[model samples]
Target: MLNKNLQNTKFDIRFFILCSIFFVVTSPFASCSAPPKLKTQTLTITRFDKSTITLVAEIAKTEEEKEYGFMNRKDIPDGTGMLFVYKKDIHLSFWMKNTPLPLSIAYIDSKGIIRELYDMTPYSLAPIIGQYACRYALEVPQGWFSANNITVNSKIDLSSL
Candidate 1:
């Protein structure tokens, strides 16, 4: 009886230690899992001079996708951005909740003309609201619009989206 009890205790201790090791090895990776896959399309911004700049834009069309937009991202390459599509024109608002990258957003009207632009601070919770109803919003790395001379009334070619 004494020998059986000793063996049982040893088994339980071994099992607990193995479980602890597994949890320790896996917990960090589980929390750092890869981001969800996103669909991409090309978007072009046409200036009044007829010059155009293009970007590879990730499409955020679903409610969940929109809610998760750019959160926790460490970097966004130049000439790349996220385009948010809505079912109807709305006075949309955005915030930088958990987003680490500084970005500038353009509010595009249904006619594909940009109506407003905002430079968002990283990790800011302050709401950035569109001045008018917009059907789409494009977010790019900070200073992208200014560097490219994109501004209000600049047209976006979203035919490829």
Candidate 2:
């Protein structure tokens, strides 16, 4: 009777351990939640013609945020974009890996003037490098710059952001 009881106790312990492992393996999938929405800021672009355009941009200030720019997004609203802020002027490179939006990025200097512009293909791993050192980068839907007449040297008004 004693041996039988010991065997039953061992079986119960093994069963509990297996159940714990199963829960640990499946917990992430079972309790998964939607990703948090990014924070947005208002920014304005001033063309050489003196005309101004306003945009609502998600601010990517942290390294993690900058790395995850626009990834998995199904769509971006018109007049919406992303602003990647850096602490200092540096040669910045961006890639479209895991990002679904067709985007155009403008590398901007500390004075808020766009220094270079490049169009990025969706999901491409190729790096789109800035032609000059930049303190910020603005990303909008592909063709937005040309369609709106925004080009290199166009000023971005970050005072309101």
Candidate 3:
């Protein structure tokens, strides 16, 4: 009688284990039926020589805005950039700090001429110190200007901004 009882207990345990595995294997497909929604905004920024590079830009205007740049965003759409507008052109500097995207920053003077360009790696907090006074700084994906043939002294169109 005791042997029969042990065998029944072992069978019950095996059945329970099989049920657990079946549930675990099937749960993932049930929950992964849809893609998660994301938030996005529209923006536009132009470049020199009247050539407009329309893109979705995340604008950073104030001190708070500058401090919290694009920290959490993983992917930035092609032709989109982050624009940093300041009151005056001065010795401006930026760091990778919390920014997770690899970017190239174009430093523009008050006249909107491209003064300099710096390529920054993701999560690098080193300061992007500018040698001259700059009024605007445009941050785009690394090699964006080079790939688009944009260079220093090139004119950036911002009449629409």
Best by lDDT: 1
For lDDT, candidate 1 versus 3, the one ahead is: 1
Better model by TM-score: candidate 1 vs candidate 3: 1
Model 1 error, position 54 (Å): 0.8
- Clashing residue pairs, candidate 2? none
Model 1 scores worst on lDDT over the 10 consecutive residues at 28-37
Q: Model 2 — TM-score against the truth?
A: 0.78
lDDT of 2: 0.89
Between candidates 2 and 3, the one scoring higher on TM-score is 2
Model 2 lDDT-worst window of ten: 28-37
Clashes of 1: 0
Q: After superposition, how far is residue 140 of candidate 3 from its true place, in Å?
A: 0.5
RMSD of each: 3.5, 4.2, 8.9
Residue 155 CA error for candidate 1 (Å)?
0.4
Best by TM-score: 1
Error of 2 at 24 (Å): 16
Give stretches of model 2 more than 4 Å off.
1-36
Q: lDDT for model 1, on a 0 to 1 scale?
A: 0.91
TM-score, prediction 1: 0.79
